[model samples]
Target: MDARPSAWIIAAVVTFYMSAALVMVFVNKAVLNSTPDLPLLFLFIQLIIAVVLLHAGALLTPKIEVPPLDLHTAKKLTPVVLINIVGLVFNMLCLRDVEASFFQIARGLVLPLTISASSIATRSRPSISVSFAATIVTIGFFVGVAPEHTLPTASVPSGLSLFYGFLSSLFIAIHAVLIKSSLPFCSNSTIQLAYWTNAGSAFFLVPFILITGEPGNLLALVSDPKWHMSTLFWGSLITGVFGFLLCVAGLLSIKVTSPITHMFSSAMRSVIQTLLGVCIFHDVLTTNRLISLATILGGTMYYTWLKSNQPPAQSQRPQADQEALDNGDREPKVGWQAPDLDEGLNGKN
Candidate 1:
């Protein structure tokens, strides 16, 4: 008998994955808004919580094997870990300064950048259709956040938030290309790799926090009367748990759904994220931004469809493709994507 889950079960899994991915961004935004000065501290706490949860998961279930943290593996994974942390930091910074809805548009060039990075890494060019899609996304990006705007929001400084978002996209693209190089170290297991990255990030963040003087900021935040300690605690805890769940959900999503379904969900999530941003954060959704969003999503979905139809022999990097499918590139907002991974990972890995 075929043991595949029923349709409803698959639907539930996808829905849960979407919900977790969606909530992760909004929660992080809330926490960042609450403690704007402590982005590193906030990320450090989330990583610590995730690492602790991973340890607990190993103890509770034999199926979840979190390899012991050791020097050898950490050294082997240095490149991946460094890029992961950088990408995450950029992600945090971008999200911290920009409106949540604008965050996705800010990173709209991720798909194009990923394609460019992958092409350079593999020494090959993408097909015409892929190139066309990248162009559409590029056009959409320019439309949404013009470089010479007076200022989308007065509170955000000098429109550098978009620049940070662009940097985040760049690092995310680099991360996507680097994941293939690093996966072999973990025997191609996404969970195993995630364990190492999170643990390593947490370990490395201690000095980062000190070097950046976040401790002083954190102390000030605590000393201030306006901030509530519980908000930070619960926000970090909730984001940490959901972050872990989002990883699991990404894995589950790949097992039960096709690449096409995952891509559709990502587009849907973008729409919902924008709507939620408008509703909860009171983000301004201008007509130009809306058109830009639709353009980006359209180009992305079309790219995925084109890739799905390609024959197996035409695929230059199967492992990278597999990794992308196994690990969705949610990047706090699902913006970073390798050509295949970007489309596949955008749903929230």
Candidate 2:
């Protein structure tokens, strides 16, 4: 694939990705609210669906190819997959307690956290503008989640929920760094990485779900006469399907365009999700929250712009591409760089 795709193609990929991702958030939220006790089970279902879709695509599509999940590769990716599971579980935990609007606001913390983590890991300092943008994002998250924004009728997000949200963001940030570091060991295909990660995660999550007694909750939920079987079945299926699509769409978008484009698209999705939360879920959107949202969006956009404008390190750029070629077929390398704030932001949900 060309490093720089045509403008229209990039736009189309980004649009498709954003649409799928935004829809998945709402679908997952609905399912979670309907069955609050089965967050881990819900996540496991999504992972299984993703694994099936990925394998199916690999088998059926002429162009799409997946790498084998060999023992060595699995060992390397174990940490990444584990961190991802933690992030996903905590994300659902946070979502179960907090409204979608608050969830988005709390998610704004991922960018700054990722930047900080990246800086520490790479031992390369970001520019002044980057630092400033990170600071703005941090402040925006705090302002957006302030207790003053809670309406009289609205239920405040419990302290535990807030803690989980922050912890989820931190885990995601750490995962991004690990992904960047582990790029050399895996095939350059993001599709391959996603497939194996989801597959491995499904395997890892089974024991946890069983141990946590979610199976009993699930059985109770299914047996309850008040619950409509058709509704639950279809809702869970749709959420799983959407989740699979969201993962593929995000990876595809990054493949076609640069990560900078993906980041901007994610920022757009965040804004839309926030607005939809207010309009659909009747989330309290105080003036402070609105200002904070603007700040978060503005900071992220500015950070992306700065990153794009700065030239890649001359020595590192070609070597990264060469490493991709050496690892596998001449497909575009998805591993050279991590998913950054965009993946961290959405991957949590």
For each candidate in turn, the TM-score is 0.79, 0.83
Tens digits of per-residue lDDT for model 2 on 1-349?
Answer: 2355666887787887888777767777777778888888888887787777777887899556667768988888888777777777787788778888787644666666665665555444545565676677767778777777346645577889888888877776666556544545555666777776678778888998999999999899888988766755666678667777666666666567533335445656777888898887888888778887888788877765764564543335675443322121112233343332124223454
Model 1 worst lDDT window (10 residues)? 338-347
- Name the regions of candidate 1 deviating beyond 4 angstroms: 1-18, 147-152, 155-157, 248-268, 311-349
Clashes of 2: 0
Question: Compared with the true structure, what per-residue lDDT tens digits does model 1 show for residues 132-251?
Answer: 766776776677665434445543334577777677677666765665556567765766776887777777778988998999987888888988999899999998888777655654
C-alpha positional error of residue 241 in candidate 2 after TM-score superposition, expressed in Å: 1.9
lDDT of 2: 0.66
